[model samples]
Target: MDDKEMLFNSGILTEEREGAILPPEELWKNKKGGLVVVECPQRIPCNPCATSCPTGAIRPFSDINDTPSVDHSKCTGCTLCVASCPGLACFVIDLTFSDDLALYKLPYEMLPLPVKGEKVLCLDREGKCIAEGTVENITQPRKDRTYVIHVSAPKNLVREFRAIRVVK
Candidate 1:
């Protein structure tokens, strides 16, 4: 099978694969303030996420090929894993960023990237619009090709929204 088919059928980013990669809601609630959820399911020989973690919080004790499992207690929300991940599957969600707003950090590699303070359409895992989110921050180091976008959304949609699109 072709790579696209493989990816869409059962790869790490597939809907079926989300359950295997995403942590439970209880875990997120318990962690509350700072934690990362790496939705990486299919293990096809990659470890950039683990390698870029400065705190060694992204499965520091596991094998290179092992899917990243965030040690929430140890994670500092550094976001290195999000930018370094080859598949752009890594994400950092801060549920306690505010009383009614949550922060979502995602890897964006699109043209005319949204700037901080820009309003964008928040999307779910399947790319469906769920709500409107504000672009709180955009961090793109010269050395990194992937841009990290920090978006603020309603607390209720924290788990439902996974991506964003340009306002236009």
Candidate 2:
């Protein structure tokens, strides 16, 4: 079997309800798995984020024009892709453990970022907060201008935490 087939067979090509979800590499490990719903509309010339991944958990395979994807099994949810994404289109989520809690790793490039201890409302792809959550932490790597922000919110809202209130 070819790589694409293998990837798909392994659930790389996940069941996306819409464009909110990332394809390969980023599907929910199970039906109850945590999800990062990317809503980036354009797939122009962008490759830095995928190319910078240390685990190759992200597929930067052929053309840069292709949308970057994630491999949840291989992905440690390290948020490397979060920092590397030039378009700031990558995110990390951990939904394996709890029923009421979901941890989100997203990119933030803005002034006055929420502190680790600050709580914020969790928003969906359309910018509406479905639930309330706390900002667990933040990481800003020099290589990637994007700041990786870890937010802890309701587990049920895992599939909805896409962006905070900023642009990258």
Candidate 3:
């Protein structure tokens, strides 16, 4: 099953089945400029996303089941959470990079992945491609399903891209 499916079956999220997050417009608008909001889908056994952080950005707060916290102040926009999160809930956002744009980093698990500078379609949380973007960066593949891809697109598309699509 996909991550969404697993999250639903595990009963960790309160949203409708397969839906784990609220609208960014409601949950994160006008918040801290660089704060990255993460939706913890479930309370499954995992804490690497918290411990793997070098700057202590991911807050453990003395509980393994607690959701991880990324302090944007010290995040450095590192992709460590992309590689460390067993559930793939982490993402990085840079709002100041462009006046009308934002950079997003997401965990990619599909095959025939994208490369740097390659133009690809950007999808939202529902897996719908809503914008075109250039792959500005990609994290090296490790022993897990985690791989972070950085995409640059128009500012409005910033909230729409939750996934990446390689152009045919």
Candidate 4:
């Protein structure tokens, strides 16, 4: 099956879909604080990601059903869109955190939120644990109840790391 077909059959994003939405190579390679990565490939009627952006990094959609497009240059990586997105497709990756580690700000809505400095099992897009990560921080600027979990894991796993499970 084609990448798009596989994505529809299973919720997991194919490499092709992921590559299409990624920021430019130069921006990904050099940006410091963080960069928003929108994984919403389907042209669904969603605009919260674009509207919630404080820096207008996520450009206004020409059509309501159009997929989000980011002007990486304008993105401050504020992560406001992370909680606003209903599909949970938004993530902020900070590669400059350390030489060996990268920080990921992921949307978490599950019960019993993980605390700061807690150890968590870093899971991939498939929800499989691939590595252990440390919870650097947790922020909820709005009372929407969606918490943004800041997880720091090995820099090499930045692309694979997505969600976290509190280590028991």
Candidate 5:
């Protein structure tokens, strides 16, 4: 199958996909403030998410290929795992940041990075534009090229929008 087809079928998240792959809604609901969600589907040999987490939020596994299961109660939403994830499948969501909005943070490696307060297009898992989101913050260290972008969108779109596009 082509890359696009693979993305559409296996990687892209939907209600059905979330039900099958993601932790239950109660898990996410219990941690209403903030937490990390690992959308890693394929069981590749990766353990950076578990290794990078200083809080031990990601459960340990005997095999490096084991998919990460988050201990949301322990995750500080520090975003260390988000950058460490090679697949760029990790995300941090803050539901209590504001009454009207939720903060979404993800790995952004694209060039021509957007600045704080810049408006960008929020995209769903399928890369379809769903909402106009504002760039709240961008943290990029000289050592890490994969910048972490924090965006704020409607609270309802927290699960719907997983990415952002900066127009040149």
Candidate 6:
């Protein structure tokens, strides 16, 4: 089946679909802080990602069902939207973290939160363990319960790493 068909049938975003929503190459590659990546493919009636953007990088929606359109130039990668997205589709990738590693900030709501410097099992879109990663930081906004977990993993796996499991 085609990527879109598989995505619709399985609810796991294919590489093509995910790439389609990514910020421009130059902007995401050259931007210092990082860039916000909204993986929300379905056009549902949701606006938290857009409304929570402090820089207006996630453009205001014309309709409630509009998918997020990011203006990468204005994005500071503060990750406020990551914390606010109920669907947990938002992420931030910082390629400048290291030569061999990329920093990924993902929305995590699971209990027994991992701590900084803890080793973790990096998971892909299907919740399958793909690689080992380290928890660099975990930000829990007082207002929102959704925690944003910062992880560092191999740069080559940037497209594959989505979520993490706390290793026992």
lDDT of 3 by residue, 71-124 (tens): 544555566766777677777666655767677777888878888889988887
Per-residue accuracy of model 1 over 69-153 as CA lDDT, tens digit each: 7766677777778888878878888877788888898888888999878999999877889999999999863265688899999
TM-score on alpha carbons, each prediction: 0.80, 0.71, 0.71, 0.94, 0.85, 0.95
CA-only RMSD, every prediction: 3.9, 8.2, 5.4, 1.3, 3.4, 1.2
**Candidate 4 structure quality by residue, lDDT tens digits, 30-75:** 6787899889878888899998898889999889999888899998
What is the alpha-carbon lDDT for the whole of candidate 1?
0.76
For model 5, the superposed segments whose C-alpha errors exceed 4 Å read 1-10, 19-33
lDDT of 3 at 58: 69
Best by TM-score: 6
Ranking by TM-score: 6, 4, 5, 1, 3, 2
For model 5, which pairs clash? none
Please give the TM-score that candidate 4 achieves against the real structure: 0.94
Which stretch of 10 consecutive residues in model 1 shows the poorest summed lDDT?
A: 10-19
Give the per-residue lDDT digits (tens) of candidate 2, residues 1-168: 664464345523223534445534335645232444443434578777667777776665598687666564556566666776666667777665456666787788878788877877676655776776778788885454788878877766555566675322
Looking at candidate 4, the ten consecutive residues that score lowest on lDDT are 14-23
C-alpha lDDT of residue 31 in model 4 = 79
Candidate 5 local lDDT, 31-87, one digit each (tens):
654688788766788998898889888888679888787777688878888888778
lDDT ranking from best to worst?
A: 6, 4, 5, 1, 3, 2
Where is the poorest 10-residue window by lDDT in model 2? 11-20
lDDT digits (tens) for residues 1-168 of candidate 6: 998799889989997876787778887776776898888888899999998898999999999999898888999989899999999999999988988988999999888999999999999999999999999999975275589999999988777788999977
Name the regions of candidate 1 deviating beyond 4 angstroms. 1-33, 61-63
Could you tell me how far off, in angstroms, the CA of residue 26 lies in candidate 3 after the best superposition? 16
- lDDT to native, each model: 0.76, 0.63, 0.66, 0.87, 0.78, 0.88
lDDT agreement of model 6 with the native = 0.88
Better of 2 and 4 by lDDT: 4
